[model samples]
Target: MSDYKLGLDYALDQDRKDELKSYRNQFHIPKDKQGDAWIYMTGNSLGLQPKQTKAYVNQELNDWANLGVEGHFEAKNPWLAYHEFLTESMAKVVGAKPIEVVVMNTLTANLHFMMVSFYKPTKTRYKILIESDAFPSDKYAVESQLRHHGFDDKEGVVLWKPRPGEELLNYDDLETILETQGDEIALIMIGGVNYYTGQYFDLKRITQLGHKQGCNVGFDCAHGAGNVALNLHDSGADFAVWCTYKYLNSGPGSLAGCFVHERHAYRKDLNRFTGWWSHNKQTRFNMRGEFDQLPGAEGWQLSNPPILSMAAIKASLDLFNEVGMDKLINKSKKLTGYFEYLLKQLGEDTIRIITPKRSEERGCQLSIQVKNADKSLHNKLTEVGIISDWREPDVIRCAPVPLYNSFEDVYRLVEKLKGILK
Candidate 1:
């Protein structure tokens, strides 16, 4: 295969012949000082916005301006329960039933809400199990949860880490931890795709292990939601939370989505933080007696959401609806695989791909472990208008989003990196 040439020109030729080339024009690709479109490869952090976003948002803005308070019902796309509009498409993207998913709140907030209900710790089993390399927010959230429940995080929090001298996490370690601390472990919450290493854990296997040990299971799918296929329903996780700003192509800090296994759909006895929005819609205005909670994920809402953010989410989700997630993901596997192939050409000693080689283990983002490189190298790439991201001390992350990125874009990125390295 190395004998065959796969270079920038070859990839661009592929782009020239692509069926989805037209979709690239639909997005507002960011530009540089010279007014050239910057190769945006950081969709793992923040996605590019669709040009139609303005029009979709404008429709709601116009409705709000004219209809005033009456816009709740009178508007073209009524504001009363505007979030419901994005549910079906969002569900389809993540492989969930319409009733099992809801788009609301930010990612971290949804995590806390899900934990409150699902992380039911008994006297004997009160520990929270997570990956050693979980995102900072997740580490903070679980630590705080342990404190809230009168447990010391130092003792109650268990991190399933890889064995000494190994870069990748070992599932055997997780099994070993559960075997030893099963009684003390009340919850197993992991990042479906680790942000730093780009490792996508086996959700079904993890969930099964947690369930066998009598622990509630959930996933913080910030990196997994848009990139990989998270069949949340079949995985049998108690719940999962993800943001739209990344792969979902919703704007920054856009309203997040959550999943509640259909099995827990109507467990009225479950504890949850409730607000007026969580109340029954028909009887909400009455506000007379009992707190009637809406069933499933909607019941988790703490307030009526800011409509503008939801508008952005609706805009992006509508695009997903038009194209369908299956089609996008199928295209994604091929596009991202091509990216992986090119990066490996740089030679293993020069750079290492931390993301899994299998299409099943990753989405679009590839975490490149650049050897003997640091922040300065990242700055050089940025100076040239390549918009990839560097996390902490090393590892440059680049994601060629399927909705907007062309194969030519990935080809150009490799070419740029080669020039920079030279």
Candidate 2:
């Protein structure tokens, strides 16, 4: 808000009025040498652990040790239906129905599996369209998909890039690309929220554009899920995938989530790599019946998941379900806006924010481009106990997570940044 005031008292007052302020106490924030909490601004990279995570994980360990094979059906939360427990809560986080959402493989693996079903290519329509600055893993995965299908990786990839000297991607540029080459594009896959720029794309608009041109559409929402309102079901994309490690606050290398629009939930004809987990629950152990694929996003599974990892995910999802995205996002806008407001006061010529200005156009991240700055500036931020991420060149990515970051955290960050710049 433009009315945001200056100084420490203003920040303290904001935190006092914050309805979600108590949530900060629920997480285990990292500490410096003196045991004081670090100013953690990297939730976009890896989220802080919740205090309840240990208890959640230990319960599963106890079940495994006590019940062994019978834990599948007899445990407190049955291993047989472990992933099912996460489905409804996670669906609410990403705006999908329970049947449309499933916690599955890692980000890129799920992307590859979704591609197998949605990236059908013909001789004339063999190209895939992606944002020019998509996360490196997404670029590599899509390129591998092209080569796997016998197309030249370089030629089969069409990039919807930002204009020269521009940081944010424009819809007009994307429209032009589709108009000129839409007929030859087989799939349109883009990051729901870009990693570097923190620009949250209009998923429904992009999906409509792709579908209008007879192209299959999907999104890698690794950066969007739990950070914003994705509305995946309403977007009408064929599929989407996201990881739990970032804004979801699941542990590092936790299981990822996948979404298949309800329309495609029962499409048995869709090609996918499968294992026993993808078979019908009733006939899965029969060992003599025909292949019976499970319906919905669960149909993409290739193996039974690791219980420890799922336990961690369940711990995080429970918090998400309790707090809800609405409350988190409401706090996020005010927190990030205050950050932006303070950053601008450092002199616009000193640092430039590459992320979108509109709250709806971006998440909590604010990518700051410091003039004449290098990695040393980032190192300085780290030395001062401000945990943030630095991209190559000049941008320093900071996400003041609404879940645990206080308004005081944002104030202290900008104050520290102001000193570093001086």
Candidate 3:
């Protein structure tokens, strides 16, 4: 299939030819007791640490130890303005303007903060819409918002579900939901990439559809951010939120990124939850002055962020800046395509891929359904040092992350799956 050969030699040859091969060396791949690197395919869950992350994080630790209070203004990166250093590169990764992006609170926190400003409910338009299979955290966040606004969570939530027996969602189904309940919906919050199916939605199309129906649109891009070129600004969504730990390669529980479209940058009339960090930097220290909101996405900040976490983010963004999303995405397509090619060779009856076959409609992840298999298959994979994620009922999710995972890794993964199934 597609001229792909089944052998370790072919995987090695492809790795040798890969332009981004050097990037793999930059990460600290986990090793077994025998000193072999585990075939890690869970970058969608948590990325491996970059080698330079230690030095980056240590810099802040040393600055704090040596400089204390003065480190806020005198550290090498300057804690007071540390987040600004990340703005440009992070913006490039997500395809947003520098003014529209800010690295702030964690994913769910940022989502709640964004909802404060975006989820305005009226008596006539009080419902919210989300995918039926959205990540649990997002569903919780939306449901809580409904309860907070004095609406019955169950009655106020509308699900854009897949057709009967379908694993993937159809845009037409989403359109049908909007056409019938559009007037009653106040917000449309959906995941940019559906986690279980690995289906990447067209953000711009969803935005346009929701806008036509007079509903505010936003996206939880946790699975899409660095794995796919979100083109968030071009998508015209009101707001977006994503964690940096997954594809961004920041450490676990690291600060998340938020995007407020350029159009909303200067809308002072929009209600927001803010604190001292949201005050204009020019007069922020002038304690006697009245509240003056900073323009752009920075206006959403509630407090000064942890410099250590920001350092890790900076370390990761620096790499993204050098490699650029264009080159990374190119390699991702080839790598994931090869994975699909190899899996298909295993036979359609043995396995089924829920992710879209078209490259444009998905990212690095492939959700494979092993026929009549259970978690024991996944457990055996782990026993053999193949680190992957298993979703409930069925489906093993694997991501051939372009930053560090190799073609050989993909090869060995299939080989392991073959053995386990046999």
Candidate 4:
């Protein structure tokens, strides 16, 4: 691959040689009213729709129309085991065993479910720890969980914060928190990827540290799911939850995925909120039967999932399976490296990347903190059709997804920033 450390030409050349270049056509790239491409750099916010999504979704629609109640079994994809259709491929995407991964409720909802099971707090160890900049949903979920568990949030929800004047979080700070509050902390749940900064934390390290403190550990991998190799199985975290909308490219607000380590699978004695869907499949139809929880992550399901939504997830996972995450992440390293190089060439005095400079610590997203501009500049960029997202306060978050975004897109985005600055 030719390295594009300078301008658009190098980016163009890299795209020419890209093995995954042809797959871009499989997505429904958004277009302006004039039918031009919308410069979609917000894959970190929402991944583009796979062209196959419509067909996949339509398959279920047709089954529903034709089979009626029979669609639960007689259809091509049986609704009874619909979520099962996604397990193998999705297991690959998030690096979990088929037994541990299940696509069910939305992200925040799944986080609450996982917390209910794993965050079993005693009187002394009732505290929970999270990053100060976690997504608002995560913050609220943990706070509510503490209150639900009869712990005062003020006394129970601990913040693992960055040092003053720092943008990126340091692992040392986490260590300090665990050291100081280890005895009191019952759970440690951090975002695998920081939503705004695009920083990918070391899940394995975090898990080990939390376990060292005898705290149950978990992660919200909403940003890390398809963007990085989570290896949740190896990380040994108690549980994890993630969404498919972003790097997973399943569609906006699609169903979320949850992982409950196999270690916890056979523990039927553990507490959980269950329903018909979580019961043994064979006996599920036997009304008035006692709840016999299914094994592994599938046991966590409380209700029948939306088949249409599962179809969309199946479509995206199929694409991920074909290209493979290993190959995709390799390209991501090179592509994001090129973006970082070009941004630095523009000089750090006027702009700075809040995301970590180390390639291993992030995915394709680059959070640029502008020198003096605010949302007005974001509006200007939007006017010119540079479609990146602006988070609160400062930082324009742009993600060049290697799956659908070409190196040329990153080049164009950088050029637009240069033009606006000039």
- Of the candidates numbered 2 and 4, which has the greater TM-score value? 2
How many steric overlaps are in each model, in order?
Answer: 0, 0, 0, 0
Q: How does candidate 3 score on lDDT? A: 0.95
Task: Count backbone clashes in candidate 3.
Answer: 0
Better of 2 and 3 by lDDT: 3
Winner by lDDT: 3
Model 3 residue 388 lDDT score: 97
Candidate 4: the clashing residue pairs are none
lDDT of 3 by residue, 340-391 (tens): 9999989999999999999999999999999989999999999999999999
Over 251-286, each residue of candidate 2 has an lDDT whose tens digit, in order, gives 888889999999998898888888889999998989
> Which residue window of length 10 is worst by lDDT in model 1?
1-10
Model 1: residues with Cα > 4 Å off, grouped in runs:
1-5
lDDT values for all models: 0.87, 0.94, 0.95, 0.90
Give the TM-score (vs. native) of candidate 1: 0.97
